[model samples]
Target: MKTPYRLILLCFVIFLTLEGSTPVPTEKTSFQWKWKENQVLELNEYHNVFFRVGAKTVEREDKNRVVMKPKKCTPDSCLVNSWFDTYIRYGKTSGPFWKDKEFTSDFTLFRNGRYEVPNEFTMPNLRSFPSFPETPVSVSDVWKLPAEESFDFNSERIRVKVIPEYTFQGIFPWSEGNYKGNCEKITYTYPIFYSKPDGEKMVPNVPYKIFGFASGTVFFNATRGVPEFKEVKLSYTFIYPNGTVQEANFHIKGIYFLRNQINTKDKESIREDILGDLIVGYTGDPNGSKLGDRIKDHNNDKEPNGKNLGRITDTGEIPRPEKDSSLEKLPVSVRTSEDGIVFSLDSILFDFNDSKLKPDAETAVAKIAEILKKYPDREIRVSGHTDNIGKKEYNRKLSEDRAKSVLHSLVDNHKMDEKHISFKGYADDLPIAPNDSEENRHKNRRVEITLVLD
Candidate 1:
């Protein structure tokens, strides 16, 4: 026998509870599909290299920019032209890998939660945001995408199929203002299925089957008709024909904006950072604001007292070369070992397929002569290497000739003691880099000068 007021309160409480448990429909009016013309997006990526070679760490960083030039736009479909620039930097060295490559893409922003990626632009695979549902998808929603288009690989046509799944993770906060949005967490567990032409034999000890997967979270900024940000983790596994396995992992992050905002301070900061890091970016001193002038100043800066650089120990350990002084000032790298110091000059000591010393080579040899004059008792060893492009015998001959040329230059031009110096040639055997690409092949051809503490 409840009272009338008590009965009314109970009903009201029940109504509120039901409403709280129910799902809220996505607002269709807020969605905008693509960015406007002249809008630009700047992105920075810091890669922590966990992969180790013996005991060395190879850390890297990359910077990229994308500028939009909309050719056509509509609620159902949009076509946008873009310019992309990517620069990669490694300890003390950096350069442009994609140096302002341009491309065009067509997109369809559907009412249902779906995204379509550009067919070309395979280097990045999914360059920009893929499709997302127009309506908010819940954790219960099972997302799927159309199979990716086929492509040619290694003179054979290859096919790839993709299976995508999505889940609503939570809300993502915007950086510009107090705007909070939905976050969709996705995992492509069986992301790609690769298939090659029939009758293709798998090489033993080489990978035959390769699989890829990706997991990431995308922040839905529906009002802008694009995602605010996306962070993805990608991985690939290679199964060799001999049952061995290898894997690689990559992290990709992206952020987008609807309008162009000019910030001079940020621009200046980026400029200064790039200027300081170009080559020897980690150690380059900022002489002035102007990059060219600063470079000139750095080049002019010379080492003091070059003769008092390195010393020999009674325990027979070779001493470290003085930095920014004698050999380090040249384009060559000086490395110390237990018995001696090795000056490694790859392609810098000689021209392609020719061992004849260039003007710069003469200067570098003169510097070495000065160092040798300081240590008359130390013996020298010169070794040369060539890539495996030509016949093995021919390569051996070339390498030997190159080593002799360097030795002669030291003995004749610089008057280094011929008796104290010895030379050897290792043709296409001991390679510093894989001869798979032109860049790496170029690196394989090198000359080394070692000063042994005898």
Candidate 2:
């Protein structure tokens, strides 16, 4: 009696030791990003006007194309204004005014250059103008002012000023100093064309030559003056032909320049690192195959060498198959449902109302045993189930016993390793048929085998 009790206690101790020695798997980490408000730019109506010195007329022929000759002036001192209008015949369609409307002024002229008008200043009416080779006049002939005047034709000696107001909107109080403000100015030169009534054409010397001039720049300045939401106004002044001045105001509304805020709540990089480590440790693809391929492709294109090299793994080595289990040599199959091996046993394969594997189940169990022997390193899981015929608790125990019986054969009779085998017994918890029918209940009583890992 003492020996038996001692033996049981020793077994119990061994079970406890084995249970405690089991490794606890690490939990995976995920990532997300958070965004915050930065700054905004508000614009208004005060920034909407065009200034030039040209005649307005009703005669359609003379009002086709006009040019403004550049003039010399001191910085921030000159101001001029003029009205411009194009003919609009009844019952006609036309493109946008900005596409057809054009202005040419020579602030300075060292060498002659050609200017192409922008498409934004289109005529309001589709009424086509008579196409003439000499319609657009030259800048030299346009200015009627005397040569003695200071605004004479000298593009290099002229100065043009464009002042644009851009409002900044922000979440922080306007007076707060938490955020810094800055602005950038960019200038683009393009060709633009305009039409003026022939009689309204002011420059007396030139009547039908296209005047070439440089376009102005767009300015954004936070320190100079900020635009308001109501009516942000920007002024542009041009001095042309012997001290003559022209000015225009552009009225812009709802113009805001917002900057991206610094994010503090994001631990995405850390989380991604964690996930990447986990995936590499499990799936062995630290920089995922798809992502690594993309990076490699992009780098190859951008680099001068442009070599199509494969991705480098996290361990600073090219990803390759293990020597023992090369993926290239593995057999692959594509089957919709019944692709791999199948295990089937009759109803008499187990004891009545119990999960114990009977003598008759030997054939089926032998087949599975052979499979396990063939794939020694593979992990197998055996699950036992039963029909809804008895009490839930009783059925659960029976199924568990049946699973244990099957596992015992594999481990003991077939000499399979116990570490690679797992067993689970679920009574009627998961069913293959409805309990209302006898046929379905019978179908539910069975055992299943799965290949977990290789």
Candidate 3:
């Protein structure tokens, strides 16, 4: 869901190589994350947001963010299994001002800390992770990694690639609730400055001049290779050439827990109960094209459910279809994995090199829609994939089109719920087989409709 932006500012380009010019310690430790199957990680996060106008300033300092991640990692990324957080509040933490709003979503997280979610245009605050070096780090190590901060400008995508300089502060003894012992810390920060070109006039709701800085520190457990604590502070101001001037500041803090075992007391419901909130709705549209605008329109309002599509993760380990279950006898390759129940359909469902669904393919999808109705509580994702046979972007576009076709069939023709369904074009990202032979390549070209169980 990338909006084609014609403006390729200097913000979009940076050195792709790491700068390990400084060295102090010979021994090194890789900061890449390691996780076991079904491991659960929790983040009891809190946030503080501040805004300023000509003569007025409004700030909220006691906001809470609740996140849950179960280690369902593929080779490429990890499913932030289920993400739910409270709405941002502007005043006292109690009374009508208090909100229990929640949205469950599937946030794709990499081994390195980073969020793929889009940020608001006027005030850029996409919770992006400071990129980590692929190689290990030693004491006094300094490196550069681009933090891809995505935004929407005039209804199109404006991606900012800023280099966040990171320094490995080395490991030190640390202790926190449920986690204690040696932990490694990294300090990171990046600056932003933008001004309008000479000939262009300022656009409404967009800043012609921007200046900002982001600084943060992250600590990870050395033994477990996971972030145990993080604190980020961001301050920025957007000055419009024709309109009003605005300033914003945000502070984010997170307390992370790595749960190695899950017993009766470790269920999500229990965790939700601890928060004393029971509301849920739409989630962050990380790859959402217009998601930034939709959220900005709300100000402090919660995102409505079923209106815009978002990713959702299954609740617990869903059971595989039984021998006599309807799915076990379906025409597609139906299997249950750490993600969910995936329905894989081969590329033959479409015409050669075409994205439209063949008439018969529509029928097959209609059947899937009927079965999907049985699990009304579950969320759904329709992903299109292709083999390595053509231009990468072309293949991605084709996959996106094909996946949308299937999604439309389920929603329009079968009247399936669209609110809980999202589609993505993962061209050659998660391949089922290698492209070494024609047979394997054929297997790689397909569309998968997953019934993400709740």
The candidate that achieves the highest lDDT relative to the unseen native structure: 3
Off by over 4 Å in 1: 1-34, 37-59, 91-124, 127-129, 138-142, 147-159, 174-190, 200-207, 239-245, 260-454
Which residue pairs clash within candidate 1?
Answer: 32-225, 92-280, 113-133, 113-134, 114-131, 114-132, 114-133, 115-131, 277-281
Model 1 lDDT, full chain set: 0.48
Model 3 poorest 10 in a row by lDDT:
5-14
What is the lDDT of every predicted structure here?
0.48, 0.33, 0.58
| Residue range 1-454, candidate 2, lDDT tens digits | 0000000000000000123543433331111101111321111111123334445211111111111112222222111111122211111222111112222222221111112112332211111011011122221222111011011122121112212121222112121112233332222222222323367534432222222232322232322222112212333334332444443333322222222322222223322332223222133334456433433544555432223222223233333534332211211111111112223233456767766666545645655576557655343556677888879988888876777777788777778765446566788998867888877776677776654220
Clashes of 2: 69
Per-residue lDDT of model 1, residues 118-219, tens digit only: 545332234223434444555545555443423323433334566555555444453422224454343333375464347988755444565777676666
- Which parts of model 2 have CA positions greater than 4 angstroms off? 1-344
